[model samples]
Target: MAARPLDVAFKALAHPDRRRLLDLTREETSVGELVNATGLTQPAVSQHLRTLREARLITARSDGTRRLYRVDTELLDEVRRYLDGFWTDRLGRLKAVAETIDDGTTP
Candidate 1:
């Protein structure tokens, strides 16, 4: 079965290098800038950018001779919201357990 878009995004984010690329692209940046920031070869940076682009985690545009890249914040926000739901549920359970402990009861 094909992976969902969110699954693809999570997979793409699994790499530290790709995460760094996303961080660097928080501000609109070029491939050259990404290479400089990452201390990676131009081709390596391009490959990372392609992965991010495929995940819909970033957007690119032509700027004369350069290609500018930026994070697609909406998609990122969707990912964030999905993750937050899990945190919320876990925290809620923790809170319940804490309350039980405070009341001298085992959870």
Candidate 2:
């Protein structure tokens, strides 16, 4: 079975190629353009784009004979929330450690 949508989104972003593809989608692009930017085969770029679409990280539309992709703002917001929470959680733990150290607890 496949994972949840959030898991799938994160998995898609786990690949550097896919992350770059997502970033490039910020301005809408065709597979050929991404191929040029990443120095990958057109088919490879299309495959990565397919994975991103499946993960709902990007959306595509027909621009004449070419397909153009755009970033899915909602998904990006969710990703931002997840990353922000991770940093906030880490900071909380670090703060606790600092407080304990200030109390003269040595380790």
Best by lDDT: 1
lDDT of 2 by residue, 19-107 (tens): 88878878988888889999989889989888988999899999899999988878778878999999999999999999988889665
Whole-model Cα lDDT of every candidate shown, in order: 0.91, 0.88
- What is the model-wide C-alpha lDDT for candidate 2? 0.88
Model 1 Cα lDDT, one tens digit per residue, 22-107: 99988999998888888999999999899999999999999999899999877779878989999999999999999988889654
lDDT of 1 at 88: 100
Please provide TM-scores, in order, for all candidate models, with all chains considered together: 0.73, 0.70
User: Compared to the true structure, candidate 2 yields what TM-score?
Assistant: 0.70
